[model samples]
Target chain A: MATTAVAAPSARVKAKQSKRFKIWIGFLFLLLIAGGYFIVERLVQGLPVTNLSSITPWGAWIAFYIFFVGLSAGSFLLSTLIYVFGMMEYERIGRMALFTAIVCMIVALTFVLMDLGRPERMLNAIIYWNVTSPLAWEVHFYLVYIALLTTELYIAMREDLVRLAGTASLKGKVAKWLTFKNSTITESTKKRDHKWMKILGTIGIPLAILGVHGGTGTIFAVVQARPSWNTGLFPVIFVVSAMVSGTALLLAMYIIKKKATKQKIDHGMVVSLAKMMVGFLFIDLGLQFYEYLVGVYGLEHHHLEGLGTMMGSAYSWSFWGVQMFLGAAIPIFLVFNKKTGTNVNALLTAAILIVIGIIGVRFNIVVPAQIVPLFEGLPAGDYFPTFNEWMVSVGIAAMGLLIYTFGEQLLPIEEIQSSEKTEG
Target chain B: MLSNMLGSKNMTEKDWNNLLDTALPDVEKEMDASPFDTKLSFNMADDARKVINENLNIKDFHKKYHSKLLKEFGEEVGQDFASGADEPAQETDGVKWGMVIDLRKCVGCDTCTVSCKAENRTPPGISYNVVLEQEIGDFPNVAKVNLPRPCMQCEKPSCVQVCPTRATYKLKNGIVTIDNDRCIGCRYCIVACPYGARSFDFGESYEDEMPGYNDVTSPEYGIERGERKPGKTPIGTVRKCNFCLHRLERGEEPACVETCVGDARFFGDLNDPNSTVSKLSKSPRAFRLKSDLGNGPNVIYLK
Candidate 1:
């Protein structure tokens, strides 16, 4: 399989980017090595190596878990807009979104696994399926969602993969193996793939909303013990915040990749995406305001205490400074202000800020509510992730990035067929 | 005046007997007409008096009837009949288990907390039950209240509601139970419980200094998970008070109730109005933890 592909000299030619590619590979290798060290340390010492306690049972790991789940849900939702709803304007990102959704889910589930006390028994969740548990349902949902994402992604990339299979480059060789030797690209196949994508993406929308992200929120909201998290509106807020982070991530990734590759930036698309990102942010903030207002107005001691911890306590900086000021305020202003709104650089900044801000948002959601104890005498938790926990998180994230980079390099993720046909 | 409207004085033993006889006529008739069991029933009725009066081993009565009843009915003969190993599975009456903790009687001695640990042999980070003591009001106006908290064992348990795998569930009888083997140790149930009744077993233990702490025994869900080893059945799972169901199965109260120095905790069937727990549950001072949340907590407290 490896040799036959290397023997071919086809119409597709390679460009000389070896030196730059080698340097990038070196950097990624360094990250992987460093990350591997921390991952090992965490495994050996157990969760005690992290600063987590019973009070703040979840900290950065749980925050990161929800963040990635949001990314998966958001990307899948965006893909639905393209492939399912037939939004032709957004066709370019369809396959990429599906792939991103799948990868993000892997990352999310990995974070959950890392956070567990017994990682070896992870399969217990599947082996003993408890239908009543939302977490159990999520485990099943994730497996199904990943399967759907994989099938949808394969279909979305099929034609491009078939086109690449005929070329002589390493990527082409990889693409050839991806498609069975007898697999042909035909009009009917295209139509069939399109029909399936629409069906899967359509089905995926509710599954992403109700089963994945909202269910993630239900994991928190249903805990009537935590007053800050115990509200009907909480899950809705989670869905909205997911959109905020997801759109920002895709927008940032698209712009950064296009700039890096010296490809033409779709200014109109960039502006529209930024507007959509901010639009979700506003709705997210509005929902949060009402949520906070209701919590504050009720004067329930625990609820107030939770809100206080988020807004006025030591970690309030994360809520006000990171979540609101950096994540919401700056991005909203940059996207809406006359001088910055249309500028691509400014929009990119806002998108990046929103992405980072959503991290703060996720952290605030998990930590502060826990900071306020269930009952008064039960010690209030004090937690911030240790250096080891932070490093392991970074390492896991780098591992995900490496997977994405290698995936893009090997697969026909880009819309090459459409571009070539349009050129003709 | 309000008591006069619902006074028990107007009711007699005959009236109570008639009420029971009418409510459960079939069982009563079975009792009256069992020719093969006539002498035994009459003796049981007589011994039931001495057993209540002289405190005879109820286990003896159960042993005497265990075989005969199995031959005739293929099952146990009483409502609260949790017998030999197989009996819990054949619980035909569908007991909705509940616990009533009288806070007014609690002295905050942490006996329930210690007994729970001793009974469950919980690891360092996990306590299936704990007593939460808090002081209300300011300096001069303050009252030191000892609130011994066990799981509320809610009828609509939030932990059960949000559990993705349904590893935790509300039993037919009100007890909320966890299937530890199935749990992912995700601690979702711990997070979701309103009572904070649940705890995650982080696998830390007293085995390093305390000999045999890790050697043997974790009688969880009535299955003895031998050895307190790390990475075992309950090590990563979520755990909470099951009203000491294993002990309850042995016709005993929960460890917390049994060990409470103040005699504050009462364990019984809330379904039985004549049970000490039910009558105590109706006292004017009766209250529940977080009553406003409407979890319908089976654990009632006397203020």
Candidate 2:
């Protein structure tokens, strides 16, 4: 893939490319600085800087935490389609998915750290280990899942690393340091790598579904105090929506990267991935329909109040405008409509919208349930992320993107060869 | 004529005694007609007179008759009678402290709320107790209900169940205490508390309004956290009412109970069936908030 995209360019074109890259990095670095300033302020000032109250103990940080966790789990599950299930068509994005999952997990954990009032005492969650608490369980699972992701990414890159190790470029230098001196790509070595990838992918599938994302959902579901989150189906919705966001994110990244690098856009993969993303969105919408339908029909006071807050209250724009219309409906239409579905740019837009929609879904999930007063006669919670919270979040997200860009620059993330293209 | 005779400065002691004996009901005759225990009744009557006269202390009076009453009425009734006069026993062993608030008597004064703040020295945005006031019904028929809520000290505390660090836990005495030192400040416990009784100490202070506001911290759970500061144990951790364990340790009622303007709140050992809280909790009017959730709240409310 690099050879095909790298056909000798003129010096002017190379300079333009390098200048554009510098500008992009510069832009991201400035965001990092701005965000970093707020993060430090938040750290010094504590959670007081955020709009969080005892009534709404969790706000944007937790919302973003779950959002990124979903993204990570979604991307890892997508990679499983190639490594575990032998979906050759998606193999081009396979390594990208794994790397994205790792990056998203880092971002997710960072959000959690920001949310903690005593960030220094975070280790107590591990040291004490309350098995009953779903949050505690999630903490353990996240660590284990991250380790598994790192290991799997290494194995997936073993062949690529060996190939790049022979070159003198920066990627080759990093590859030389990563690979063992005796590392070779024989037929058996290839078979062994493939086997390990399958084994790890199989293990990761359950881990992601049951332990990581599902466990993240369990953190909320077991909160019987919140009627909106106490259902068994909540975790399932989490995993499904993760798939939607994960696929959308990868589709967006793939298209955006291809355009940026001036490489041939894998139009077929782009269309197929968009369809897969929308399919997950439809399932997510259906599950959410029943989730709300059952909650409404139950007529339980807190549950109904929670639903009312999400659907009709001041925050309903997030539900109707962002989550439903832009996130789900538009994306579904774009993927299914023949003309737009085939248009690469249109599909890209749908993918980006879906990713943004999932953010709305996550915020809706976390905030509304808390905004409903735990008991009648108590003050109803009012919360919106403060400027500090938004800035800190932007900083953290930019930091994740920066890490991804650096990783792409240094590692053999891009495929060396284009495999057989499956028709979309 | 009797007043004139008594006013005579030289009224002799024997004459005064004779006058008292004649004026009062015949004690011997009364005791003889009452029951078979005339001797014991006569002794009690004499002691009662001495008590009224302030010649003997009440503790001695009860102590003197304790054995006789036990012999006469058997152990159970005897114990009840003895305890009625004796000071309440300071038996903390196996004690489950509980509260029963009479909502009708609350008056919506917010005194409990204020006194709790002063007593606990909780920072801004952190109130261990609050009165939830609402008007029920509509228009002319409306009735205001004042629900003074403190930590329920739930038997099955959802906060305890969800605390990943076991920092929040139910003590043997039924009060749920948070170990701020061990807490990760995750706020999961706050989310899990059904009563909305928990607060994350966001390190906000009234220092602007009252200088030296952070000079001394409330000794919550008997842990003497000296001063409030950023990143302190409680400053960044979750906190809730421990039923004022420090007060309980010193044999005082919770601040809310002591300062309630309406005299609505009763706090005592729920394990002691004879305690005021236990009796109040057994009343037909007594109920707990969100009892359907089955947390077995130690805080009972009288409607």
Candidate 3:
């Protein structure tokens, strides 16, 4: 009777855990089905089904596309800080950063595909190779950046994969398949993997800054017609904001995963990461302030109109409420306030809010400029994403989360040993 | 009898000839008074009579006397004569098509807008051209300005510069054309156009209100896009004015030019210095929209 009582509790606990997991899977599956139906309908009916018109050709999908691109670039840059710059303190989330970057890139590209009126002709952008186009350049850069990220991630994981290869679990099987049959866990192989990671990470710095994220910013910056976007400082702001979002995402993911798995949270690392994220945010704000100040002072009609739309229009709440308040102010406070700075939960909230805030920032960047008519006498565009748009976005985001979860389960994403044990 | 015959509705051929012979001066005497050859003039007169009777064409007569007429007149006049005679084979080399809109003449009737829509067969929300009407200054001292806007066909078109696919391009004739089959409907061009000239085809049709609206598509850029079905090449692509190239191919003016009530719009090859647009473009009152931006718009507006 005593043994039955002891075993029954454990069985109940297992059932509870599985039920939680099943519910999560069910939620994602439901999102996918709902989103999939709309996506198919969009393809069948074309862009007419959306609220988008000639006046507002780009809407929610484009906003989400750039948003995910920012996230991917941000996270990849964070990983580079760890591997290339020998920022060993932030090494715990290095692999997670790389993995998050890849997942975000997938989601971003999916958003772009959905935005395209003729999604079938997407490959034509590559096949026809318009060298003058910043967008074409971005497409090529994305592909190369993704390849580089995958390689860097693999090298980072070699030691862990080699260690896990001997087990009889799913991760073990994946690790065995990924590594060569004759791969060994020797001191020399470890040194070699670390050396390769450093080299790739060093190469990745320019690729991420000048090619990936900075290039994404250049796509908007090179638009000479939109005077607000036509500036040299825009790309620099993109890189800085990417650093902020990337750090916050990794911090949130790390803390949340630890809590979920009932593992020990690294409070010191979490605090330090939150500080770094705020530091980047401050720089981004400074640059943006100057950008807006110069644009306003220029007294250019179109530039003023664009800024007015972003700051004073109906959607200004996204800029003032979400971007400034939740994304910037609260997160900065959470990181700086003596009471909340050290609290893991508070820091986690700050990190999540910052991530969401960056999304608002991206929307502010893409939507406002488009809403301002290119000509003065023309009617201004009014756009809010439709129900179908929100649903598809949720589906795409859920897909990215599901990918991240599966990747973590099948890969050695978590820290295998305590910091002290590793040091020892 | 002469007054009666002159007033009569019916007159015999010999009687009409006799009346013309009596009324007209002697042709041989007039020809001999000036110019080179009497026989050439006599032959021309004979050919003119045949031409009047529909037995010989005027073009054939010109061809028969081309060299003789060139010789009778020297280099400058000779060149002018030859060009006037060979008007059908007008030289299109170095042609830069341009438009000159006389704003003072425009009545803001939206005739160009309606005609452009009919000619282009553009779908809902896709206007290839528009006329912006606004009253400037305060209420006490207000003046309404009507600006008919078309594709500027800029020398450095921002749309062409930003297009991820090079589906939109400028022809040597200064008309900017979109290869709808190649366009992926990204609408980047629409966003990049400074003049708000480009539009995206969101697949909306006039079929809801106008039956058989999609039966035939406009032959834009001289390509006969047959039907206006959903998911068709242009139905899901970016679109803009191509100066009615199909009409230009048949030696007809753009629909906007043909149908303008005030005759405010003029279209011609600007490369020809003697062309009407080229002359108007050089006028002191002529200016381009946002000229300081240096896009070098082919569409000129006369203030």
Q: Which candidate leads the pack in lDDT? A: 2
Model 3 docking tier (incorrect/acceptable/medium/high): medium
The lDDT per prediction is 0.81, 0.91, 0.86
Candidate 1 lDDT by residue in tens digits, A1-424:
1122333323332232444556766787787788779878767656777887666778899999999999889888888889878888777777778888888998898889889876777887787676666677788888988998898898888887888888999878987898886678788998898898888888888999999999888778777788898899998988988888888988888888766654557788889989989999999999999999999999988899999999999999999999999999999999999999999999999999999999999999999998888887787889999988888788778778778888888888878854453334
Ranking by lDDT: 2, 3, 1
Q: Please report, as a residue range, the 10-residue window in candidate 1 chain A with the lowest summed lDDT.
A: A1-10
State which candidate, 1 or 2, has the greater TM-score: 2
Lowest summed lDDT across 10 adjacent residues in model 3 chain B is found at B77-86
DockQ of 2: 0.60
Q: Per-residue lDDT of B1-303 in model 2, one digit per residue for the tens? A: 978876876888898899889899987788788765988887788889999888987778887888878888888888865544546764446899999999989899999989999999998888899999899998989999999999999989899899999998888998899888888889999898899999988888899999999888888888888878777778888989989899999999999999988899999989987899999999999999999998999999999
The candidates' DockQ values read 0.37, 0.60, 0.49
**Taking the tens digit of each residue's C-alpha lDDT, what string does model 3 give over A48-154?**
66888778788888888888888888898888888988899888889999999999999999999998878889988898878999888899999998999899898
Error of 3 at A342 (Å): 0.9
Docking class of 1: acceptable
The list of candidate 3 runs beyond 4 A from truth reads A1-16, A418-424, B1-93
The C-alpha TM-scores of every prediction are 0.81, 0.86, 0.85
